[model samples]
Target chain A: MATTTMAAALGSGLRRAMEDDPRVVLLGEDIGRLGGVFRVTDGLQRDFGADRVMDTPLAEAGIMGVAVGLAYRGFRPVVEIQFDGFVYPALDQMVTQVGRLHYRTGGTVRMPVTIRIPYGGGIGAVEHHSESPEAYFAHTPGLRVVSCATPQDAHTMIRQAIACDDPVVFFEPKRRYWVKGSVEDEVLDDALPLDRARVVVEGTDVTLVAYGPLVVTARDAALAAADDGLSIEVIDLRSLSPLDLDTVETSVRKTGRLVVTHEAQRSGGLGAEIAASITERCFSLLHAAPVRVTGFDVPYPPAKLEEHFLPDLDRLLDAVDQVMGRQHSLTGWSA
Target chain B: MLRSDVSDGRALPTTEEPPDPELVQLLAPDGTRRADPVYDAWVEDVDAERLLSLYEDMVVARRFDVEAVALQRQGQLGLWPPLLGQEAAQIGSARALRPDDFVFTSYRENGVAYCRGAAPVDLVRVWRGNALAGWDPWAIGMATPQVMIGAQTLHATGYALGCAKDGVDSVAVAYFGDGATSKGDVHEAMVFASSFAAPVVFFCQNNQWAISEPVGLQSRHPLADRALGYGIPSVRVDGNDVLAVMAATRVALDRARRGEGPSFIEAVTYRMGPHTTSDDPTRYADPEVREQWAAQDPIVRVEQHLHTRGALSEDRAQEVKEHAEAFAMELRDATYGMTAPEPLTVFDHVLVQPSAELERQRSQYAAYLAMFEGTSGGDE
Candidate 1:
């Protein structure tokens, strides 16, 4: 086992997949010579020749459309969208073609295209660079949307996403790319499926469901809650589409309280869906209504205001305290 | 509308930027054979028997289009995009392709689909709303017609790129209309195909109108000239002439297989019918222009050429007519007899593996559907 950053682990995972299968190919802008904007695909082109690791023109639609075509021809193509906001150019292809081809063809064909996007904020980036667009892909059917908060999950999930027969939208939290953890070289046979949620830090008083970047923030909130004698369970939801509601529901049922956290807008985000599903399934077990700590409904603001815009540990604890029937974190601040 | 001079009866420059002035004609509308200096060398392989076969193909395709339109009118199909005047362009290029060569086309490529060996029953499966796409792409080597304009060009380019990587000599062909050239996807495809030297053939059937918008609105110059800007070799062929289209496609395919990168062919055809069953071409196209193009009817010109050569005798014409009628009748029967698919089949292929959310919804839907079985519309 080697300790590595999330970016390095992703590169190693891609390298492992490409080594195992000759049909595995990588295509993206600046992926060949530059590794990647975040270097998530570092040294791949050198080892796997220029043909397999293609540095395409700066066109997301072309990248995605070609990936779909490559998938049609029995090649597993892993594509990288440079940033979260830049993925919109390829959304038409993602939603209409990649998402519908299998279902539209009625199971005869499969789309094994894995699109990797470095998403979310806290790197103090400019407009279009630091934005969370996971909701857009999670809402799209026929696409397996996933996010990894740890290096181990990033390493395992990327290969799992590539091995999957359906198309997957893999979102890597850009700010957390440098967060390091140990990754086993050989994935265990009983490793968790790519779509399930795992309880990172277990407790009993309240349940904190989070994914991607917010998982870290949620853990910090849990640790702070522990100091106050309120046990908080932190569940890292790996899959956003299939949602792994069973793990979340089981945890929420045991805790009898729930607080969903995400970096996306409050309305119609994954938090909303999780809250709704939890309320429907665990209605009798709940001690309080599920609360959410999420990004504001406005556009991902300029870098100066982004710190205030994103969900923080304080914001998460505030939501947790509210669900626990405690006094408001900020006593008359809103008013 | 004749952008270039046909003074020599060989060159007709439609675009301002002329890579080659000739439109590459093999047979003219006047039942005369016209040879091109470049494309004639390519069509030498096309014998009398091949010409007759192409004529039969066009005749069958036109019949299929007519039948599909009638079916749509009778409410058998949800919609139909008729490839009326563009049969020669579709059939001619498609016939040039080997069965292994994959095809990615726009929704208006029923003729190409037929040429790719999609059964008549499979053809209308999507239009009948029985399935999303009629045939399996892996079996036919042709993807389902992409409804998003010009997007298939990128897919074709990408597939061709994969072919190059796999060391496969097979080529990918992208079929789109003139209006699709204005799309970013087309431009991006061209750029990548040129940059990577991917073995892709961009076949643009310039059927003149994208619904109500004329080709003139999309391009100031001929669409073929745009290919030159991307450093790809291009050809402008008489789309109504089957031999010319075949020659152009053959040349492009040869170049692609020889690792000569990508080539573009602009087949200047016209859409004689409405864009789809929902369209009214009369609203946009002038009658006089339509009449002028109608004079250059693809199948009629082929028949005239064969007659001038004393090859299309009365018996031959009767045989072709019988073949077309039989094929059309078979298609009509198959379409009318196609039963409605089960309602729950909609949730069948949403993912390769079963999705829990979709599974839950499917069971809920099954329960809902089951509830209706003995309800008797709540009349009791």
Candidate 2:
């Protein structure tokens, strides 16, 4: 095992995939010579030839549309949308073509394409850099959506995503890219399933569910809650689309309280779906209403307000308190 | 913009040929044949057997089109897009393709699908609402029928680019209606194809009507002339004449295979039926206009020419009828027997590895269905 950042793990994973499959290609703007802005594709073009690591035009739609055609011709394309807001231009192709190609062809064609977008806020970046748009793709039927929180997950999940036969939207939390963790060099003997959730920290008072960058914050909240004598269980929902509701329902049933958190907008976000599903599945076991701590239902705020807008440990702990029927006043509470 | 420059040049031909520049009609309405020596080299290798096959294709395609319309009227299909008068254009261009060539098409080209080896029953799935798509596109070297106008053009161009990168001689074809010319993707496709010198052919079946909009609204100049701006050669052929369309497509496909870059062909035809079964053309079209195109029916012209040459007998015509009826009955039976897909099947192919959220949704949906089954006497 070796300690590495999430970005390094992703770069290493892409290199491994290229080494494994000659047909695997990486296409995005400013990915080749400059490494990506986030450096997720650093040293990829140098390790592999230029043909396999293409520096495409600035057009996202063209990148996605051409990738579809390339996939049709038996090429496994891993495309990178530089930021969350930049992915909107490619939405039409993603929804209408990439998502529907297999069903529309009656299972004749398989689009083994992965669209990687660095999503969510907390980096104090400019506008359009941080937004949680996972709900849009999760709502789409034909596509699969997933995100990674740790370095190990970023490495393993990306390879698994690239190996998937269907089109997958792989969202990477930009803020978590620099976090360091030990990565196993050998193949995992029993790796986590691609579409399941994992319980990171076990507790009984309340189940705190989150994913991607917010997962770290949720873990921090769980640690702080433990100090307060409240055992807050933490569940990392790795796959957003085919949610691992069995794990969620099981956790909610045991805890009798739940708090769903994310960096995406509060209204119609993925957390809303999780809350509703848990409520429906474990309605009788609920001790209090499910509470959600998410980014406000507004545009990603300016750099100064990003921390306030993003769900931090305090905000998540407050959500836990609310769900656990605690009466303590929380930090950063607005008048 | 119309300028008369006759003073500085020689007199042009004043014969009774098409006044529209770039329009080439080799076969007259009266079944008389005319030839331009420049185009003779393209058709020199085509023999009588091939010509007879082309005619047979037109006849068979028309029969199937009629059957589809009848099926729609009888409520077997939700809707049908009839290619009644455009049989020559579809069959001619489709038959011209070699086994290795790839074809991308918009919906309404059932004749082309037939030419690509898809069974008639396979084509009924989309209309019956049993499947989102009809046939296996990879099995027939064709892409799924694109319903959105002109979107397949970009896909075809990109595929051709892939072929060029691999140095393959296989050519790709994009078939669309006249209205597709107005879409941004079509123009983008042309630009990309020309820049890359991709081996592709843009085959447009200008069947006069785009739903309610006429061809005149789609283009000011002939559709073929639009290719000149992109530095590609274009040809306009009489879509009603199967022989002419076949010859034109053959030359274009050959040029593409020889790495000569993309070519555009505008097959001028007319939609002899409504846009779809749901459309009522009686509200928009004039009776006299319909009569004018009916007189130039593609199938009748070939039938009459073959009969006069003593190549088609009454017995042979009867055999065609029997074959069409048999195919139609086979399709009806297959469609009637198609069952709704299982509920869990929805989660089967979403991804190679099902996601946690999808797994949860699938189980929840299954439980919902189970609850209903337990509460009710029947599973609906």
- lDDT (tens digit, per residue) of candidate 1 on A88-173: 99999999999989888888879999999999999999899988888888898999999999999998899989888899999999
Instruction: Score residue A1 of candidate 1 by CA lDDT.
Output: 90
lDDT of all predictions: 0.89, 0.82
Model 1: CA > 4 A from native: A332-335, B1-22, B378-380
Candidate 1's residue-wise lDDT over B1-380, tens digit each?
33435335565322222112367778887667886888889889777778999999999999988999999999999999999999999999999999889999999899899889998998899888887788888788999888899999999998998888889899999999998999999999999999999999999999888898877668767789999999999989989899999999999999999999999999988888999999997776777778878888899888888888888889988999899899888889999899888788878989988889899999998988888786877323
**What clash count does candidate 1 reach?**
0
- Model 1 chain B — which ten-residue stretch has the worst lDDT? B12-21
lDDT of 1: 0.89
Question: DockQ of all candidates, in order?
Answer: 0.84, 0.37
Residue B57 deviation, candidate 1, in Å?
0.4
Highest-scoring model, DockQ: 1
Error of 2 at B178 (Å): 2.5
Error of 2 at B90 (Å): 0.8
